[model samples]
Target chain A: MREDASISINEIQEQIIREMARLDDWMEKYEYLIDLGRDLPPMETALRRDEYSIAGCQSQVWLMPRMRDGRMNYVADSDAKITRGIIALVLRVLNNQPPRDIAAAELYFLDRTGLRSNLSPSRANGLAAIVKQMKAAAAARMNT
Target chain B: MVFTGTTYKKINTAQVLDVDKVRKDFPILARRVNGRPLIYLDNAATCQKPRAVVKRIVDFYTRNNSNIHRGVHALSERASGEFEAARETVRQFLNARSTREIVFTQGTTDAINLVADSFGADFLSKGDEIIVSGMEHHSNVLPWQRICARRQAALKVLPCEHNGRLRVEDLDRLITENTKLIALVYVSNVLGVRNPVEEVIRRARARGVPVLLDGAQAVAHFEVDVRALDCDFFAFSGHKLYADTGIGVLYGKEQWLRILPPYRTGGGMVQSVGPERVRYAGLPLKFEAGTMHVAGALSLEEAIHYLRKLGFDSVRAHQRRLMDYAEGRLRALDGVTVYASPSRRYGAVSFTIDGVHPYDAGLILDKLGIAVRSGTHCAEPLMRKYGVGGMVRASFALYNTRDEVDALIEGIRRVQELCGECKSTRSLQ
Candidate 1:
């Protein structure tokens, strides 16, 4: 997926929508999300410090960011598997994208895929916060 | 169709309250959640209102809707009569000496704050000490903390054991001559462990320290005789007692109520207001200033009647059985840790599962139409003591059945599957 850094944000969202459409119901969608979470890379023990942690969510999520080849890279993990899976989805679309592109992308697919409404309020807030964190990181790199 | 699993016995619902029949009284119980029947396990947060309580609220608004204590019209007189009647009901319910001891406040927190502010201002001073237990909800702890900070009084904690049960022996050692008051929860909201109230009260009395029992959790499930316990103050919320929100009682000893300054002063609380000075009303009215929760008080009377009619012995027995059954089933689940293995818990149970965050488990349970509370349950100190981020709590009531516990077990197992192992072969590079 990193090889396709040139992929447009809209194209990535379309791919996500098509993938979500394959699921018939909420249970299936939840199961799929859990599986995605299960597949998330285990965060390093050293990186799981308070500095990297996001505070507002019901569950603890740790995100590590890096800049390489003029693209923003985010590696995230959650104590909750479903939440980790949601982070995985966010990473899939946003990672390896140029800072400017990542900062400006609307990511309307969250609403279009019904993930925003389907999730619990705290989780939904967490999702939005993660996006903001990503955008803030991008916006910071732009300022530099 | 009897549902039974290994080490889980089938409960005879007839032996207890007929949960199905009781369930019908609550209209909210019939509603569907995510295409499944609703299973309410968060009774400690707030129990669902029964038809009797709801009808009383509607009836109050329909017929006797008017300001209490001051109006000259028929509606006012009737409303005032009914409101005082509700106070009498609360007095009887707690076995208080008189209705004069019962003061209406917004809720348990409000009631506790009333005592803290009024009592602390008068009795406390620099270097005075107040003793609280570790298992108290933020509501119980904060008011005392505020008072202590204001008066320069030291706040002491009677710490709980690793199992979340406070040791009464610790109280004796913690209480010194500087100890002016002892405030504690009658039952912990998070762990469902009933505190050693008798032992706590005895120690406090020996020291001549006034005690306040936060009965917000215990009132619905346990029989609390304020006269028997002889606590200086008892506070509880009506919402947790199956009545409407915004109504609660502060049962203070008559002597204490008389001595403490008026917490808040306004229209109803004053007897005669002169430009130079104002005289406060007696007993309860001094605390219950302004227009009250007229409808809420009436509905609370209905809730009290409903409980008394059902009887406490049966209710306690039913809930004890439910708690036992719930703990046993939860313990049987693999990789599950059930907290507060106290010998006598009435209705609440807290647990955590390995490899699953409590929030994740709670979310999954919600999707399955089971409502369990997750997070610290407003007892962050208790959580810190246990060394856990949070827990999944399922508390019971008279309406909760064995079937709900079974559903909870099944839901947990499903959560374990959803959260446990990853089938995907992808690896972090």
Candidate 2:
């Protein structure tokens, strides 16, 4: 089994929305975020060049989102497989959702995926960076 | 199904590798997995034990188990004899000059860390280069990286090609006089690419740079003759070789090991301890810091013997056939992508499906009773180079069969259907 199977897609948006709401300390929701990663569709490999890369991830990450039927459909890859899973979790709730909805995702899906319990603080920070990227993508989509 | 015709001929020709006789040796292969017969394809991760090896371990604990070298008692003598005898078996297996060249550790990771902490840190000053390939497992890559960070050595990487193969030229470009160590993985855990270690080692030797091989995946799939390969240092895990864990082999050129510092210093390794200073023991003893994994060493001997009896040529051909069969079947699937060609293939075949994420695929496969590995495979750089974040890896061994591959193919098809027609996601090339 993939070591990163801690999260599921269905829970990604829900966790993020809840975390935003601060229903529980975001610190308590690490596993949920990890689980959200479990179902992330990997970024397609064709975009592995320097342009699509996510900087500062312990493993390199490349994210590319396309507009399909006015919703965001993402193709992402990571030097770290688990990080790609994390990307999938972030994209599930944030992608192609309305800009306001994307920006305002009220749930911290990390809780639902049980991510907070097992991961390190650095990983937690990495998760936050990915979340920030997704939010940025959503905001850009909204403006577009 | 996962069946490959090459795998069939391999199993059939070795007729000695009969599924029934071979299957009997492995205790776990007989059991049910996920309610069906277990089809373990995770051999690259760790092989299940044969009764011969497992029975040896049980017998040691029941009959002659004791701390080795320290006690002059009968039990310690027997254990020490058996443990060191195991080292002799390994010495013959890898064809080293002496058993003293082999030092036991927790596993491959520890062995690599030993090289890093001992020789790597001591010799590699800042600005010196340590060349590694993109396909390294964290075990091989991380240690040198850490040691380089400490010693101010530069870490250089050799890129893998579309075929996932590393060329000699890439190594040529990466190596310079400043290249103190060139560490490469023997078999890629994810992409199944086999590096040209002999050529790499020969080339590096001429240049005065030491070469280390992470043989964790290769040792299980091929006949590893360290003297034949002539690598400076070789490391592998016992678990991957069908022996128990908590033990591994780190083989260095005896002359080289003599000069390098020890990895960990403690009671057993120390000949005598002055309050502020300690003198270390000799050879393998100097490296073993505590009471040894006596049983682990003994069982490792059994595992090596089992492989010798099995014969390397038959096993290699058998596993290659299985890989071809499985790769062909996986290729037939809609939206499935399998990388690394047969010419360069090891027992491992790593690929991805269009619609199913690797984890979901793993989950569904688990439910189907077929065991495989998924995710980055601790090879992030290699994964990134391939434009994938992760993949599902199905690796075989001497005991695996065409029928098991069939089960794997069917399970994959089941997951693919569940995820729906995913042509949009497909990339077989």
Give stretches of model 1 more than 4 Å off. Answer: A1-5, A49-51, A64-70, A118-125, B1-16, B422-429
Candidate whose TM-score is highest: 1
Please tell me how candidate 2 rates in CAPRI terms: incorrect
What's the distance in Å from true for residue B341, model 2?
A: 2.1
Which regions in candidate 2 have their CA more than 4 angstroms from the true location? Answer: A1-144, B1-15, B421-429
Model 1: per-residue Cα lDDT over B1-429, one tens digit each: 133432223354333354566778899999999888999999999999999999999998999899999999999999999999999999999999999999999999999999999999999999999999999999999999999999999999999897767888977789999999999999999888998898889988998999999999999887899999999999999999999999999999999999999998788998899999999898889998888998999889999998777766666776877788898999898999988778888668899999788888887898899999988888989888888988999999888888889999999988887776656442222
Proportion of the native interface contacts kept in model 2 = 0.00
lDDT of 2: 0.75
lDDT of 2 by residue, A1-144 (tens): 223543434456655555445524322222233344445654557777676665542345566656665555666655443455456655655664555455556545555555433223443224455556666776687656
**lDDT accuracy of residue B369 in candidate 2:** 82
List TM-scores of chain B, every candidate.
0.95, 0.93
